[model samples]
Target: MTTELERELKQLIIDTLELEDVTPEDIDPDEPLFVEGLGLDSIDALELGLALQKTYGIQLQADSDDTRRHFANLRTLATLVEERRVK
Candidate 1:
């Protein structure tokens, strides 16, 4: 089951990446966001990172393992936003 945060994140990913071929309903929260599931590349990651920061006031370190873990999928990304986003 997808949480509200996950749903929102899915839309954010779509909008941020200009994924005209994708839709929020098409995204599987458990699937990988990069290289396989969504087939997003490193450039997509950078774009998504800026979108997340701008939207949620979340900060990230470039090339960090923790950042990689958070970006692993929709669920983890939502969790990161929930935990660190400014109110």
Candidate 2:
């Protein structure tokens, strides 16, 4: 179940970020997305937040204390949606 969530989240990240060189398998759920692993920047975070808002109907309050915690990685992002998204 969580694997599926991870995959879906990975796909969403790749699609939303326009990562032409990356596949769903390229992402590491526990790795850092901003500094090292996937090399995402601030703009990418904003884009991802918008994509999540559109796709999962979950809004991320920009620059909040929870934003970093929520968008930490694919796992965290998926968990955030699973926890907050309405049916």
The most accurate candidate by lDDT is 1
Badly placed stretches (over 4 Å) of model 1 are none
Estimate, for each residue in 1-87, the C-alpha lDDT of model 1 and write its tens digit.
999888899999999899999989999888999999999998998899989989999987665798889999998999999999995
Report the Cα lDDT for residue 53, model 2.
84
Residues 1-87 of candidate 2 have per-residue lDDT tens digits of: 348878988988899889999987788898888767999988998899888888889976656678998878778888898988864
RMSD of 1: 1.1
**Model 2 TM-score, all chains together:** 0.89
What overall lDDT, based on C-alpha atoms, would model 2 receive against the true structure? 0.84
The true-structure Cα RMSD of candidate 2 reads: 1.7
Per-model TM-score versus the true fold? 0.93, 0.89
Candidate No. with top TM-score: 1
